[model samples]
Target: MLDRRRLLGLAAALTLGACATGPSIHADYDRSVDFSSFHTFSLASDTPQPGAPPLTWQRVSDAINRTLQARGFTRSDTPDFAVGFTLGKRDRIETWNYGPYYAGWGQWGGGPWGPSQTQVRTITEGTLTIDVFDAKTRRPVWSGTATQRLSGPVSQAEIDAAVTSVLAKFPPGSTQ
Candidate 1:
């Protein structure tokens, strides 16, 4: 019973709702490593993509700093772990094709189908990867990634939320 305008509006609302939830966060760590032993961390010399926007690294670093501090970690010159991140983006294209599979016509067929239709959308997806390396081994012990569709300029709170969501899995264990 929905008209074309109504259907389009509903789709837009659903897309916006998905965007509001921000990015999807994922984390992975060496199960053999004891995260409890990690008490102090230092910002690694690693930098974001050299061509990245000037403030992207600053914002990401600040957000990571705040999140780690809140999780009972300290910053030190000679640290247990080195924290770093990488930023990247890519264009994603999604296409949806409906109909042509059934014997149906546009409207009035008494069937719930329409004419063969196709919708193609391109979304810019941004990825942020946070890595934690053992200072002594200089190898990664944990990594978290956040991926989301980028629509416009991002805000600090959004950055913080993305960082927080990823690191929430830190010190991964049954107890945590």
Candidate 2:
């Protein structure tokens, strides 16, 4: 029974460690407009929010650009729509665990034994936002964001993934 608890604890730790500041922004797009026309990009706002130290910005932009290029977008002087984004994270701590103790299967009421420690975890948090705008009109058009708990130091790879996941939703044509 103790072995099971240890296994459960270890699995939970792996999940926590693998987790970033928030859920990955899955790139979903409106199949209305054609994405090929998209050219040129611009910053919506230079405003920066207080986020996970600095791992925030690099994570968002790099991911967006990479995703766009992968889908066949080129950096041009003039383009279809304007792109603007902001990155930030916040220090979030909850009374939630921060630590977990497993008493084993038998220890829990579920098992055929005694009581077990309640499973809980306090998660730190962070958020990222990307705002897209109409280039010709210079008005905000589409935007996407992602927020997650701050488990630990975020690497460039994770940031890129989060950004990629979110921007994948960028509207191309627009049926809606």
Candidate 3:
């Protein structure tokens, strides 16, 4: 027996789950290079999208630095690899149509076949791409990217989560 409260809760949970999807993460590295040989890294540069907030960019940089350091990679003026990143965002509109059966029972006086209901929401999607370049060769050795929906103002925790997800498979082989 599905009571009103339970049914409503289930509906809300499903809706939220559909709206908040996990970040899409992708990473690749050059197999010819010896990843273990690289022990030091330095921030080379960052290209944030036009009109992007500087504070958000800083948070991302800080998160990447922390993640790399935790993985036993040291920061140095003369590094074996130089790290760079780019940030981008775009607006997206999502529409969901619950055809003829939303909130079918209650004081609202709708039967099992209620009128169609549609939901439209505007959201911001953000993408972060990190690149690692061989300092000597000045060529890209590794790259990772993460794309996800941004809810409200960006926070350090959010940035950390995204960075962590993106870099989860760095250095070609070692599991971290």
Candidate 4:
């Protein structure tokens, strides 16, 4: 059970959480100083929709690739690294029907009411995951995930923002 007043206060806070950024990259530069060093890169996604939006997929993917390239990750036959993401919605009932009370003229009715308090909740969630591996060893070296709200049918700009925010936490020089 949650406190009524407290929950109301947290509504805005949770909404803002959707805008929260991803992790941070503080490790040394990865072993792969250049894109070629890793092998190849590909994006693996299970995004809610199939068809890409106007400039949304292209823009977001390109930006993600660029970010990886800048970080020294390369592109190849079998990408040594893979990028994946997901988006979804969850119902959150912010408010509900409370007692029909007047605070007068009622013996059994606590507040002269007829009904009790009831509410439903709805929320949306989005997630991004990045996987890095060693081509030679055929093993994943590291991976990261960032989850938040869709807020809406996110635009290309929004996707970029989300991806950028998440990748910003990639570890530096992650490879051994």
Rank the candidate models, highest TM-score first.
1, 3, 2, 4
Q: Judge candidate 1 against the unseen true structure and give its global Cα lDDT, from 0 to 1.
A: 0.74
Clashes of each: 0, 23, 0, 23
The C-alpha TM-scores of every prediction are: 0.79, 0.57, 0.71, 0.50
Candidate 4: count the clashes.
23
Full-model lDDT for every candidate = 0.74, 0.53, 0.74, 0.50
Worst 10 residues of 1 by lDDT: 9-18
What is the lDDT ranking, best to worst? 3, 1, 2, 4
Error of 4 at 25 (Å): 12
CA lDDT, candidate 2, residue 28: 37
Kindly provide the TM-score of model 1 when superposed on the true structure, using C-alpha atoms: 0.79
Error of 3 at 17 (Å): 15
The digit string of per-residue lDDT tens for model 3 on 1-176 reads 34754443332222112125667889998889998889999988755434445566677788989999999999998999998987765668999998775656563664556678889998766677899999989999999988776555555666777788788889877788
Candidate 1 lDDT over 8-94, as tens digits, reads: 333222221225557888889988888889999989964544555446667778888989988889989999999988776666799
Q: Assess candidate 3 and give its TM-score to the true structure.
A: 0.71
Best by TM-score: 1
